[model samples]
Target chain A: DARVTQTPRHKVTEMGQEVTMRCQPILGHNTVFWYRQTMMQGLELLAYFRNRAPLDDSGMPKDRFSAEMPDATLATLKIQPSEPRDSAVYFCASGPPADTQYFGPGTRLTVL
Target chain B: EDQVTQSPEALRLQEGESSSLNCSYTVSGLRGLFWYRQDPGKGPEFLFTLYSAGEEKEKERLKATLTKKESFLHITAPKPEDSATYLCAVQANNQGGKLIFGQGTELSVKP
Candidate 1:
């Protein structure tokens, strides 16, 4: 079955530590999306890329969070000096033509 | 401002029960509305997509209907496997296909 894949399904880091999450989108998808899920905010789109080009990162905190698609098959979301409040599940998704974003198993991050 | 809002933040039902969840949205130019089912600790699974008002789609026990300003996901005779957080998202035509998601409706079905 073709599915979006993510590594390091769970992580725990001290506050102010750097964390990197990886995703391998389904082959042939043209779009990638990064989202954060929390009890208060629900599922929030942090950033996305179209054809490996970032379309938006405005929702992401520039100082702490960054998303990139170095190639068609790989995408990454990195957080530097992560805070306790930043502890949440980060999800990566992919789609063709950017219509229906198919999500991978999320990476749960816990910052102390 | 573009937004999607889902109602009844949570619901609990017995097996074979039926119910409907609502999603209201306001977009500059509506490209499409999507529905998804998310299991705990897992990313969302795609359900349905509606592009026009009065549109409807179905699969198994789920059906989605769209209108001018809102959409509804109906679950009929639901099973335990149907329990999950149902999310609603809207795509703006001018916004390059980024999805604005709702807070989601958490559903639990008991045997």
Candidate 2:
């Protein structure tokens, strides 16, 4: 069955280090979304792209976080100078316009 | 700002029992409401989507219905494997497909 895939299912990094998480959306899907889940915040939308172009990143910290879709199948979320507060499970989801999103297994990141 | 709220942060039910989860939302315009089931340490799995009020969808033992301001996911005769956190999200007409999610309701099915 077709599904979204994420690399480095887990990541551990020291504070101030740079962390990058990658996602491969399902084939033929044109929209990708990045989200962060934590015990305190529940789930928060960080950014999303449509047709490899970012539609919104307002929920992300522009000073340290960046999201990009290098190609239709590859979407990436990076954090420079990662902080302990950034520790959370990051999820990637993709879908067609106004359709149900297929989520990846997610990358659990722990920043010390 | 668009907001989604799910009631009963957690729920426990005996096997074969039935219950419903509520998701209340406020948005400028509702494009779609989505239901997802998430297991520990995993991503959210899509369950159903309701586009308008009075719409209903079902699969297996789970059924979802939507109204103008809220949605409900009804579980009937749940199994142990049905234990998971259920999430509700909404796509607003102006959000460009960005979903606003609820805190989720953690359901536990006991035998």
Candidate 3:
């Protein structure tokens, strides 16, 4: 079965640390999306890429957060100077031309 | 501003009970409405997608119907394994593959 895979399923870091999360999309998918989920905000889209090029990152904190799809298979989301408020589960989803997306298990991050 | 809202933040049902979850949305132009099931400590899984008003889709024990302003996910004879948070999202015609999600309705089924 084709599924998205994420590395570093759990991460705990102190404030001002850098955290990087990686995702591997299913083969043959062209679109990738990044999302953050928390109890208060629910789920929010952070960024997305189509064909390895970013489509939007408006929801991400530009100064501290960055998302990039270096190639077709690998996508990464990085946070610099992380804060306790940034603690949340980050999810990566991939899809074909259709809008329906398949999500990965997600990376749970905790900042102290 | 485009927004999506789900009612009854949580729901509890007996093993054989049937119930429905509501998702209301307001957007400039509707493209599609999506339903996802999220388990504790896991990512949301795709359930169904409704394209327009009067559209309906079904899978196993769940049925989803969409109208102009809202959508409903109807569960029939839910099992304990069916317990999860049901999320509703909408894609606007103006946005390319971007989805606006609701807070979600947590469903608990007891055997």
Q: Runs in model 2 with CA error above 4 Å?
A: none
lDDT of candidates 1 onward, in order = 0.93, 0.94, 0.95
Writing each residue's lDDT as its tens digit, candidate 1 over B1-111 gives 999989999999999999999999999989999999998878999999999999999999999999999999999999999999999999998787799999999999999
Candidate 3 on B23-79: residue-level lDDT in tens?
Answer: 999999998899999999999999999998999999999999999999999999999
Question: Per model, how much of the real contact set is kept?
Answer: 0.89, 0.74, 0.63
Native contact fraction of candidate 2? 0.74
Model 3 chain A weakest 10-residue run by lDDT:
A93-102
lDDT of 2 by residue, A1-112 (tens): 9989998999999999999999999999998999999998998999999999998899999999999998887999999989999999999999997678889999999999
lDDT score for candidate 2 against the true structure = 0.94
Residue-level lDDT tens digits of model 3 in A1-112: 9999998999999999999999999999999999999999999999999999999999999999999998999999999989999999999999975489899999999999
Model 1: per-residue Cα lDDT over A24-110, one tens digit each: 999999888899999989889899898899889998999999888888889999999899999999999998884788999999999
Top candidate on DockQ is 1
Give the interface RMSD values of the models in order: 0.9, 0.9, 1.1
**Cα lDDT, model 3, residue A27:** 98
Of 1 and 2, the candidate ranking higher by DockQ: 1
Least accurate stretch of 10 residues (summed lDDT) in model 3 chain B?
A: B91-100
